[model samples]
Target: MTSLTSPTSGANRPARLGVQIAPQHAPYEKIRDTLTEVEALGADIAFNWDHFFPLSGDPDGLHFESWTMLAAWAEQTTTIQLGALVNCNSYRNADLQADMARTIDHISGGRFIFGTGAGWFERDYDEYGYEFGTPGSRLNALDDSLNRIEARWGKINPPPVHDIPVLIGGGGEKKTLRIVAQHADIWHSFGDPQVLEHKLGVLGEWCDKVGRDMSEIEISTELKTRTVEQADQLYDLGARLFTLGVSGPAYDLAPATDWLAWRDSKNA
Candidate 1:
């Protein structure tokens, strides 16, 4: 079995379940209630995405902010790990983010996963008045921000209770994959079995180039659009962490039970 320090150390382990309780088109009461149920449902992780507006349903839907809700969840839930599915590095300074994450880690007693990525949604930039820089430029900023974030983590008083695992979300081959090899404790991506296999090879190459152990990084993927059988295929290809993504308003978890059952069987 793998220790929490290296959650992805073993070639075989339980298929961990994660749910993104998308904070959009729903009241905080409903969102809060759903989060409680998320932990009770036995999901290994709970995530809320970072964005100003709803990505689905209505363009002007009721939506809560990400980090604030996370802080609340840190105080609310007892066990399920919480964080943004992918926090936008372009939205805030890395130093502030490091402090916020450290505080949440303490609040949750060390269950926060720092999942982050380069910002992609232009609407978020335009509406919030951030520069919609070129993709390459944004990637560069993310690369720089991670360094600052790590440096800040060291300097922050009352350091994080745990190692504060880093999860980098992206599939960009050149800059993003290299960053993952260097920094991520978990790498989340959206790809089918074939695509996942190909990306794993590319990631392995990046690990070789950087001289890091690929086995140390957990492989995470979304399960919102795939079937249990399809997820089994992904697992065969080295993806162990599966996230069932449900957008807000209802916070549907009925569909996730099947995946949870599958996870149980796989672990057994």
Candidate 2:
């Protein structure tokens, strides 16, 4: 297992805001425009999810593919790092995923973060003709995929312009954290401060067992119904990258503007 500690990930790093523009319930132009807006608003990262169907609201709402849109986003925006908030590892071959990431990295001038995880959307699997295996099987596959992705990054031509950061999403303590200790430069979870503190402890245990420094992996979490003061509690627990998710049809960025203001204050 390779250590993918990012030069930019650490507790001391300035706090940054990420906006996940959900690719559902809207037209592609709206989604693209939202990405542009996020960048203009000073978001450090712009993200989308990798699901075939809507994760909320209308189950049959309009949606788009994750990677292709990311490729286009590479050309559409500059300066802001972008990627799927968490890509489904089972959707494509590991090597292919790595190659595509490298291409997007080049296209974005090295601003792509390879965010991925063991797939969990059963609807996606069932509807897209992918085998919806049990949780353990998907995790095992994710472990294998990470190893392949890292190896492929090494073999690919015109390799990623930078040591592409890998962001692994999920808070499963046993297998997921262990894999995170091995491969991730960033670990994202939806855990509140209390839960995040406990999970960080568990992740520390895994890091020790795997001989990886816990400080090497940056902590990330979502800002769902949490106040900035509440987010401060998470910051106290070592979360540096805070994400705010906005769904489409109307990707209102008012909250993102507020979050970005908070981020500016933190960094200041």
Candidate 3:
């Protein structure tokens, strides 16, 4: 297995900007439009959460499966990278997940980052007939699945165009962070600067124990607002990838642009 490390060179490294397009709230065309606008505006990656139904509102509200939408986004966008914010590992077999990711990697010409996690969101499992086990069991499943994913990738006839970057999202102090150290190319968490600072500290401890360099694991988080001023603190704390989520139809680009300018200025 390859070491999951962040790229070096802090100041010269280009900040990554991404956006999550909520698939539950909009039709396909609207989702496509939002993706196009995000790409046009210089977003580095595009993502959608994996869930069978609407997570926030009505149980029966419009929602789409993650992989299908990713395949479409891979085909539609010319430059922006694409993937699920975190695919539920328990929902599919590890080998199947590997194949699906490889297919999408090809579809996107190797831009797919396979973000995954132990399945959460009880409603998804209970309603969809998947077993909703304890968190430990789910994490165990994720660990095994990741092993199979990497093994299967090696066995495939035509391998993925590039080694698909594995992204794992969760802030679990023990199991999740351990898995991130062992497997993830990127670690994503949602929290304020102080919380993230603490988590990074813990993550660093884990990296030391695992013999992995903490700087090699790219830190990613979602931004509710676009201002780089707020993001500056996170960047200082080692978060170089900032993502802003926009729901569709009116797919607002203002916040995305604000962050893009910040990224360019930093690069400049």
Per-residue lDDT of candidate 2, residues 1-268 (tens digit): 0222222225577899999999999999888888888999899999999999999999998999999999999999989999998999999999999999999999999999999999999999998899999989999999999999999999998899999999999989889999999999999987667777778888888998999988888889999789877788787677899999999799989999888989888888
In model 1, the Cα lDDT at residue 109 comes to: 99
RMSD of each: 4.1, 4.7, 4.5
lDDT of 1 by residue, 1-268 (tens): 1111222343565689999998999899999999888899899999999999989899899998999999999999898999898999999998999999999999999999999999898999999999999999999999999999999999999999999999999999999999999999999988777677778888989999999998988899998778767787777767788998887777788888878988898888
- Model 2: how far residue 9 lies from native, Å: 9.9
Compared with the true structure, all predictions reach lDDT values of 0.88, 0.90, 0.84
| Best model number under lDDT | 2
Q: What is the lDDT for 254 in model 1?
A: 89
How displaced is residue 173 in candidate 1, in Å? Answer: 0.5
Better of 1 and 2 by lDDT: 2
Q: Estimate candidate 3's RMSD in Å.
A: 4.5
Clashing pairs in 1: none
Give candidate 1's error at residue 120 in angstroms. Answer: 0.6
Q: lDDT of model 2 at residue 202?
A: 86
Over 4 Å off, model 2 = 1-10
Query: Which residue pairs in candidate 3 have backbone atoms (N, alpha carbon, C) closer than 3 angstroms, thus clashing?
Result: 5-216, 6-216, 6-217
Q: lDDT for model 3, on a 0 to 1 scale?
A: 0.84
